[model samples]
Target: MALTLHGGRPGTDYDAAWWRSVFGLLGECFPGLPGGAATAEALGFPWADQTTPFTLSEQGRTVAHVGVLAHPMRLDGRAAVVAGVHAVGTTEAWRRRGLARRLLGEALDWVDERFALAKLHTDLPEVYAPHGFRVVPTHRFRTPPQPPAQVQKRLLQPLRHAADADLLRSLLRLRTPASNRCATADPGWLELTVAALSGALSSGFWHIESHNAIVALGEEAGGALILDVIAPEPPPLAVVMGAAGAADRPVLWSFSPELSCDRAEAIPTPPEAGVLMVRGDWPLGEPFGISPLWEH
Candidate 1:
């Protein structure tokens, strides 16, 4: 039987039923994951005008799926377009059939036509290496124990309006230029980030304001995760953690090491880093950083 290829911009070319099938497959493949139709909608998957979704269907049922996010990034100080490949998956029965590979190949070809770089963070690097992705070193920082004086909770404003989204976009812009490889601070992308973070954390998207800086935070397992920090100078890690009500929980940072606390520890890269590969040449040298918030 021949497999049919379906390609389109979600919410326009495709309908909710299609997305429900895709999300259902993802749920089966990745049990315990917190993503669903609601999460996908929040992440701009349904209304992503700039993104292309490719699906392979057998008898009108989607078996394999991949999403290509048209991400604008700064590479070596030059503005460039990159495809952030994400949500590549196949139904359990479809595994070992090269469906995912075919879907990925199609996505790469699509990206090659319009972008200079294609990147993805995944746990199956070997599966994509043949497709032309190389793993780049990434740094992870662990917060140090906070001093008692810094344990007092600070006010955190929840992201609830378009104004807050605009503020986040500005903060993202302020931080991205400092990194060699980073997603552009487009308003749509920032709103997507806020939605995704809010869905993941019961507390929703949060920001803290200090005299000198503003920071975005996400909560996981009762611990705070630093999503982004916008400040003229790096603020005290303890203070940031305290503001998020994570004084007792270790804060995990995915941003640059320079923004981390002086006493923070540099942890070893995870085994999955081996599969977090990039295909095209990124002007930035090795040891670059990709924030966790921007993974999808």
Candidate 2:
């Protein structure tokens, strides 16, 4: 009699109040909440009807929320494209309970089998392993980018309201090819992101001609500034150097303690590392059962 499950998008019974609760819960756990109402509103996100926001309620009141997005991710081999997970959270009052587990189980059941892998980045691995999640040690890079000198840059940052959904979708397709994450980015996603990004790390977008897609988040501790999602061949440092500019502005990236690539600098710390976990199937497709055809 305590729990009842239902499907609701972002602004149903799960509107601003519910989101306020969820974001506050995150603020308690992490250093800061990345994209919340304040940022979303400023960015002009069309949040009343955002996609991929599903909730779990108690007596019709939302207690938990999580959703998926199929953003573009780069992989090692010929794994095609994939969908990804984003903005997953549960209310603080509902913590330590099996509510999240239940919600995710139900959510995955409907993710069909078209995905090569169901992917999500998480700092908590032990909590997810019991649900058949595996660990792929990964890095979350953050740096005060140093854009090339005399380089031309553009500042056409799009908020959620005026965001190009198809273009963002296309970018995701190009970024994470083999992922099975549903697309969580709507106008609101970018709206919220752009709004939050300007203040993100005190450094904003540092576009480098035909080279990078740089952007910033708010001036908070947990905020992030993304420099580039370049081809494997491009110099990884292009983003860092570009974002921080020639002055070496404050910058950092989160890389798993066990993961490695190329780093001329390191700020190794336990809290900085993260493990990637998938709640459902990998290469999320029929063989694994997480495709768009069977969506919830």
Candidate 3:
């Protein structure tokens, strides 16, 4: 039988059997990681509206795949649309057949027609270099913890019910980028997925009533870590820390706190941490880290 190529949005185009095939492919390719489509479905995330996928199949079985997630982002304080390439994989039986490269070519050609900039997170930069992606430097912000500044004025509440999730979903829709340098405007889906996967969605998500913000925070042996912050207008770092009960310990930021860069040291992200690659003229500035919310 001849091989076939297919393209569509995951939410709408994928039927149950089709998803099973994709899931099987993902299981074979990714091993222990949760399938992206399954995770999104479990969380009621609207991925079909956000991502476009292309696949190659033989004998009604998916053999290879590539996905592009469209994102509204802030690049150098300017609004831009970015294409996030993800989920590239090939079935074991199809290895060395160039199926992955073919799908990548098709997906990127589609990206080039509508988007000027594209990005992907990967440990293997060599795989993508020939396709126009180059490594981009990223940094994490760090500051020593301080004593409690003042009595907390804001309250942190977890998403305990459907109402809370709804509230969080609403807030996410209105959220602005935490950084004007390089940040995502709609990070809700990825944020929720990361939280769910890390077991933080239940214990770490907190909504600040007074400020109308949601923070993914956790206390670790080393310090208090702020994973991601979602708000219409992000409050000052102190306010966020105080509300999340990080007033007295060292703080590490996974995302760029664009406003507070001067107060914290910017450290080069070790190569083993993760690699960021880009395929367009990168915006100029001190290298900024994207929120883990964009990690997909």
Candidate 4:
């Protein structure tokens, strides 16, 4: 049997049924996850030209999928296009058939035609290494056991409107880069992320006025997870923890090395840590990192 490759912007070639079916497979693979088609829709799928969906089908039924989000970023101070490859999955029945490999190849080809580089975050680096992606080092920070008492007075305002989105975008522009690899957090992406992640994180999207920072936080079986953070400086790790009300819980902060803050422990390229896989010759300098906020 021959497999067919089909793809298009979310709403055009793919409809709600297709989106649900692909996300259904993903939910089954990673149970207890809240995101899927709904998140994609909020991100302006089909309508948003930046995101494109690809699928592999056998006998007219979708079996594998991948998505690409075209993001413009500064690579060593030069404008570069980075394709964020995400939502990659294959139905359990289709595993080991090379469906994913074929789909990835097609996606990369598509990316190559329009973008300067392709990037994705995954724990399974081996799966992407053969495709020309190299592992870029990233750092994870742990919050101190006892947060500063002053943080108790600080508050995190929930994102509620366009103005708030604007603020988040501006904060993203601050901070010096140790390396050139970084995503441009335009207003559209920030709004889409805030809406998409609100359902996953109990706290949803929030910003600290006192510290000029924004964060997406959620709780999982492992305790509290700081999914993303944006700030001028390393806004106090303790304050971020306090703002999220996860002060006593085990908090994992994913950030670039250029951003500094108090940390209980510094993780150096752990296997479990998210590895960046890229295709093509996208030059990266030392001390490079992409924030968790832009992972998907």
Off by over 4 Å in 3: 8-11, 31-36, 144-146, 150-160, 218-222, 243-249
**What TM-score fits each model?**
0.73, 0.56, 0.86, 0.70
Q: Which stretches of candidate 1 lie over 4 Å from their true place?
A: 8-11, 31-37, 40-50, 141-199, 203-205, 211-214, 217-225, 230-252, 257-267, 272-275
The whole-model lDDT of each prediction reads 0.60, 0.43, 0.73, 0.61
Give lDDT for model 1: 0.60
Model 4 CA deviation exceeding 4 Å by range: 8-11, 32-50, 141-149, 152-200, 204-206, 215-253, 257-267
lDDT of 1 by residue, 36-85 (tens): 33443553434345558898887777788888887676555567767788
- Candidate 3 lDDT over 73-166, as tens digits, reads 8789899888889878898878888888888898998889889899999988877998999988888777545553332342233344667777
Pick out the ten consecutive residues of candidate 4 with the lowest summed lDDT: 152-161
Candidate ranking under TM-score, highest first, comes to 3, 1, 4, 2
Residue-by-residue lDDT tens digits, candidate 4, 1-296: 78787875442566667666665666766553336345534434332345687888777677888878877665766776678888688899888888888888988888888887788889788778888888767665564566543443322332344465456446555633322345444434533453354443224456676766666565544766565555666565557667667645676655442343523465554565467877777676544445555566
Compare the candidates by TM-score and give the number of the best one: 3
Best by lDDT: 3
TM-score of 4: 0.70
Candidate order, lDDT descending: 3, 4, 1, 2
